[model samples]
Target: MKQTSFTEDQLTDALRALKADTSDERFRLLTSEPPKARIRPLLWYGVAASVAMLIVAASIWQSSWSIHPDTTPTATTATVDENLSQLVGQSIAAQTQAQQQRTLTNDIVSEHLSLVEP
Candidate 1:
């Protein structure tokens, strides 16, 4: 028997099409059946949700701006200038130390090369 196998996507698409056709017929059928969903309750739910979200957003914004303790420039200008000068001095010292270390290493490498060549 030559059995035909369908892929998952093909089966899902077939089921989806069937469901759509049946739903369309059901909606078109004019019977005394209760409605599936009421529009008025859903509309009210959406309005209530929108109002709650607006209130929450407004409170968040107002709270964020309120009681802002001047967090910036906590350090005085005198201390900042002192710290800047100190940093500059430390940077200069570090460069001088690095140059001296490089000079020493170069001299040692050249001495080793000379011995190796001879």
Candidate 2:
């Protein structure tokens, strides 16, 4: 087995070499300026997107309101009431017909059973 250790002088020399390889001036130059030219286009794109969204929202709002113009609620209510009453009358007539059919079926079934029993 072998154990390796760095002495203080060797560690100091390695650190000095590493520090000499890195440049502080390059880092300062990279970070000094805000990227204004790139930022302006992105800002304009965002503004254009918001305006487009507003226009779309306004159109949707206008179309929805325009589709159903202002009319008296009573007229719509009366039409709905007439339709509902017709539906109810048809439903009642169908139920009565079904009841009559059931009664006729019951009578026929009872007559056949009686004849079979006799």
Each candidate structure's count of clashing pairs: 0, 0
Residue 115, model 1: Cα distance from true site in angstroms: 1.0
Candidate 2 has its poorest 10 consecutive residues by lDDT at 68-77
Tell how far residue 112 is off in model 2, in angstroms: 0.6
lDDT of 2 by residue, 39-63 (tens): 9999999999999999999999888
Clashing pairs in 2: none
Off by over 4 Å in 1: 1-73
Q: What are the per-residue Cα lDDT tens digits for candidate 1 across 1-118?
A: 3225767887787777774445656766845445545777788899999999999999987776565656233567788799999999999999999999999999999999999995
lDDT of 1: 0.80
Question: Ten residues in a row with the worst lDDT in model 1?
Answer: 65-74
**Residue 50, candidate 1: how far off, in angstroms?**
43
- Identify the runs in model 2 with alpha carbons over 4 angstroms from their true place: 1-75
Best-matching candidate per TM-score = 1
In candidate 2, how many Å is residue 48 off?
28
Pairs in clash, predicted candidate 1: none
